[model samples]
Target chain A: MLVLKPMMQKTSAKYFFLMPGVLWILAFTLFPLVYSLYLSFTDFRLGKEPQFVGTKNYVEILGLDGEGGDDKALETATFSLFLTLGSTSMTLIMGTLIAWVFNHDLPMLRQMRAIITMPLFAAPIALGFLGVVIFNETNGPLNNILQGLGFERIQWIIDPWGARFAVLITDTWQWTPFVFIVVLAAMQSIPEDLYESARLDTRSNWILFRRITFPLIAPALGTVALLRLVETIKILDIPISLTGGGPGAATQTYSYYVYQIGLRGSFQLGDASALSYLVVIIAIIISSIYFWRVRARFD
Target chain B: MDAASSLSSSIQTTHSKPGYLPGTSRIGRYLLIGLAFFFTFLAISPFLFALTTSFKTQTDSIDGTVIPFIQYQPTLINWEQEFGLGGTETFKSLRNSALIALGSTLIATILGTLAGYGLGRFKYGIGNRNLVSWFMSQRFLPPIASVIPFVLLFRDLKLIDTLPGMVIINATFTLPFAVLIMRDFFADFPQELIEAALVDGAGHFQTFRDIALPLATPALVASVIICFSFAWNEYLFASVLATKEWKPYPMLVAGSDSVRGIMFGFVTTRMLIAVTVPVFLSLLVQRYIVRGLTFGAVKG
Candidate 1:
């Protein structure tokens, strides 16, 4: 039954299947990545030749060159960090609660879960457009509901803190379902007999969660948290749509800042490339930690 | 949750409920139910508001009238303006979006599946594990980092604002997701079938095509869904590359704001159109959502 193909023929088949993907990645990702790295070191613009400046762009973006450097980058970077922490924590806590609440068997839950998860797929830019109306100080449903509840109306889009809150809540609403779904899957994977045995030892729900549920689901939570953190750090679309970095740049995120410098304003391609590399560095650091932890668990 | 409580109460009034702990008071149960409903409302409220706003007139939209007939008269002017005869830009954008998304998804899925199958079934000089990790790292590369180079490159090739160009870049970023997920799927596939086919004198490609490909349909479909959505929702590259006649619908939605502030009626219509495309296709991917979202990390 051993109808053996030649070794040379087998190797040809492998390359025939694999070479297209490799070529595509080379043409699109690796070449452009290297090109952008070169761009980051030059003084490039839309209509001019790129002259290599050798770390000047990085120096200016890092605010080490005080003359031409902008402090706004630092400010936006801080805001981005705050937004990442704030929104990621909120998404995690809310996701844990919702997933825990819905972990049990229920009627129509399958359908409800589909509905709840819809926002995960919605376009963030579109959500931002809707946010303008939803968070409208006057004649918006959110403020109207708050007034009905005997709370003061907020200047959601106009005030600085309110604009920040608008971005935060919008992001949380969009991503919490991700955590919910992953955590729910994790929780459901715990053996039923394990929980049954634990119930025999404890009459308190909190104790059962602390002893059985939390430890079992902790890894899943950590993975989701880190994933959400990375995504949040790169946020650009919602701020573009919802606030447009308005109310005195209160909601300008780091990605938005990079876009402003590179594409929108002076078309500073060099600085933009440098800024982009900075983000890449941060992302690489975080993802490295994620890989180390997650790969260890999987192995 | 309510169902769990009822099952517990009906059983022996004991502490043996599998999911629910021994003691959840009636108020606690009610609170959980309340929280669930409230969150469910919060989850869909934006879409709900967009739906109503799509049907509202400019004045009535900002007037805070939510109900259709009682509070305000619903109108089709917004929808008509967008989907009707005067909506040439909208029509073109929708067509461009569909073409780009479909074109990229087709290319990425085919290429990714082949590479994934090769990686899964064969040994290579660079180990399959390292190759998979390389692809995964590509998935994490920030689009901003590449946008400038892409802009310059596309301009030089005269590929800017063209459907093929958009397809190339989108397929680039989305290709990683397809590769990673398909690799995971193929890795976990049962291998006895391949050996049987080989023993029957079928060549490797024949086995992969006739036997393995059919069995890998679910993974293929999942990869297709994910790649399609990522391309469809792509905005950054589209924003820079497609300047003129080839602009996608997301650009239209993001640029819907008029000089006189946001025309709520018009913006809402575009917003709904942009969102409905992916959300509608999402139902087909319900089972694959967790795995797809996490890039097949935590398999559902």
Candidate 2:
């Protein structure tokens, strides 16, 4: 691996482009993350006069947080799970539905596709936070709808589940198109004959779907779900913007916990890094699972 | 959607009338249309409400009871304040956002185009796959992992909440996409063109500048639009990295700290401003998106 073969040696110009990217990622990305992991294990809260309290930070944040401690890990886990599950499932379902709509051959289909993808393109913090204002309980547009439907306007921001659902709805609205775009592309690539052959077996559209459509799109669907899972897990802005993971940590995702600990509320840099390291480890594992499946498919 | 689906259904029938019942096909079509309507509604409701809410007066926004389709008056009060005709915080945010997005996108494009060319023409063996995948993975690296790190890094560097800071962070993410897209376009080019330039005694840089650059115009335009829109719409990194005074446009609207049910006119105006640039850019590049998608697998 250390030996530079002759072919590699001649590539001075090529190395220039690739190296900068590698170095940039290393400096701002790989090194920082690794540093964060190291810090996670230390007693590194701001103004605490720092110490090497090995594994104390991790244990504390992971729920064995000793008495009178924050119990942050326990608080964080429930909310993160709810958040991850809610956002992921909603995006997957909506994404597939939208893809099916966009898959049909139509003039301006591409334009519509781009329009659908617009939400994801919009910065999450801005659009997502703005959505919070729009969905506000007292004067939120959603309550207006609820009221109009012959029901009482309910508390949106006040309830943990309601806020969580609002975050999910907005995220789904934004990201469904991502899955849609990829799935539509996969659907387009599918051999038409496969669908036609399914048609030969039955005229029932349910049969056509059960036997043909769903199975064929499974890989794409799975890929999108996996991608959404990894992306959704890191979400900080949307939940933070909408609910502050509020109504008592109902929406506080693990990533948001990292923010709460590291920067904004507490400034517990060491604890935050530890929490983030835990989050990264989980993300890595999830991504590995996705890649492992993808590899198996190719093999 | 219904009209197109029906026509396509007829075409499907013509290709070969399947053994299915006629009633079920129609029902299937209706179900699909219903689902499509629900999806489209879900997709556009945010925009629609944002549009309507932008026009609502302070009273109406606080009341928050504006009904859809029927009932309720739409006002232009919010829009006015946002445009500064009504005198509000709207214009300031918009201006800050535009400067940062434009500044970052331009820098990212230049660096990326060069990097793309380098990757395309030069061949290297060791760590190539890992390197390429690493670049792609960075695209999906989940913003959460990097946001905190960047906040700490930028603060120490004293670049927080500034346009230059936002531009640099925005450029890193854009760099990978720009390189990947441009590199693929380069890979598709015939080597003969470059060889001929070399035979004509042009130096490597000159060959790339005169020959390759002109030919990659479509790709350049596409990648530029993509990088620009991404920078324009960037929310998370900018939110953490830049505060309001130096806030990028998207951060202004999607701020995590917005006071609940505040200004109606201001909100609408910001929404319009936040959405306008990227929407316009996407429309301009709409023609190239499908072709550009192939960049994922095939390299130039």
Candidate 3:
């Protein structure tokens, strides 16, 4: 068998197989990433010859320029951070609670699970449009029900806080099911023996959940939260569709602000690139903490 | 016999649990079921409202009635406008989306499967772990950071607003996911089958083609569906890279908001059409989603 084997070296063959994909990543992903980083240092506006500006864009964006700094960029970063924390926390709590309820064997459980997760499949752009209709103050069902219940109808899209709330609600709605599905799957994977022994000791559901379920599911929840954090920071479609970054710049997330600068507005490609690098830095910091905490379990 | 006894004992222990005590637990279970139904309703209500409103005429959609078909007679006008003879732009956008999604998915799956097979089966000086991690780190690069370069690069290549260009970008974005999922699938597969094929004098390619490929049908389907959904739902690249000639369905739906100004009927109609295929496919492959979304880090 050894004598009959082909003479091709397995190591080289593996490299041969990996060549196309590696090249694709190098050309499209790595090359572009490096180019963007280089562009961040230059005055690379659309339709103009690039000139090396040497940190001016970064300085301006960071508010370190002698000129009173970019207030809107700071505001956008704050809003993105706010939205990330708010949405990720809400999604995790609601999803875990709902998953606990769903961990039970019940009639029509399969179909119910399917219905709950349906929004996770909807395009975010489409969900944004749905938000427009559902959160419409005048004729939307939400305000209509509010009025029907003898309460004054609140302006959902017009008021600033109202607009922010609408975006948050829509974000939570679209993503909670994601957290729910993953957490539910995690819960189901817990060994039945752990639960059985815990129940043998105590009839308190809370105690069993705290002692056994929460610890067991902590790693999975951490994974889900980290993923959601990265995703929520890049939220663009929902806010764009919901309020177009609002009556003011109330809902302009960091990515949305970058989109406005780079693509839609002044076409400040250099500044946008610098701003994006900042966003990536923030994401790396946050994810590093999460990974460091969870490293022990995986090892 | 030992396994059977353990299983029976586990069942006995479960049944004898104090938590299962009579009417109290039964009532608790009912309450839990009620809560599940409520949350499910909340989850589905927005889309349901959109669906019902899609069937309403423009006037009826804004009638301020929560009830559909009862508060007003449902009409087919919206659906007609979406699929009718005059709906060329909408139809064209849908076609563009389908073509881009299908094209990218096919390319991603093929490239990803080959690379995944190498990483999963072959041991080398560099090791597959480093390579796999490098592939996954691509996803962490925010889209905003790359969209400008892509726009410029695509323009230089004269590939802007073209289906193939969009396909290339989409495939690049989805390739990490596809590679990770397929690699895990191949890693989890039994090695004996490949060994047996090797003993029969099959080369690496021959073994992959005749033995490994056939057994990987489930993973292939999962990867294809996942890649399709990512490409289909993609908006940022599509928005920037593709202009009118190849504007995808998401762009069209977003365009309608500004161009048509809350034409609830048309917006809902376009949205329903845009989401139908991906949503249906996702439900079918729901079990595989956790694995794909997490880059095969956690099993569903």
Query: Fnat of each prediction?
Result: 0.54, 0.28, 0.55
Interface RMSD of 1: 3.1
Q: In candidate 1, what are the lDDT values of residues B219-272, reduced to their tens digit?
A: 787788789888999888888899788999999888887534777888888889
Docking outcome class, model 2: acceptable
Q: Write the candidate numbers in order of decreasing lDDT.
A: 1, 3, 2
Q: On a 0 to 1 DockQ scale, where is model 3?
A: 0.51
Q: Choose 1 or 2, whichever is better by lDDT.
A: 1
lDDT of 2 by residue, B1-300 (tens): 344334333322212222221234556666655665666667767777777766666676666554734655876665555464643455666677677667877766676677677667765564444455555566656566676667767878998988788877877777666766776667667889998986796767778899999988767877887888777777767656776677666655764246434565566557666776665565544334433432344110
DockQ for all models: 0.51, 0.33, 0.51
lDDT of 2 by residue, A1-299 (tens): 44565335336656655666667667766766776666767776666755778888766654465555456666776677776787778777767666665555444454455556566556666566667667777777777788889898767778767777877777777777666767666666666677666666777756766776688778767767777787777777677666768888887877777676677777778777777777677777786666555432111
* Cα lDDT for residue A102, candidate 3: 80
TM-scores computed on chain B for all candidates: 0.89, 0.75, 0.90
Report the CA-based lDDT of candidate 3 relative to the real structure. Answer: 0.82
RMSD for each model, in Å, please? Answer: 5.1, 6.1, 5.6
Runs in model 3 deviating more than 4 A are: A1-8, A287-299, B1-24, B66-69
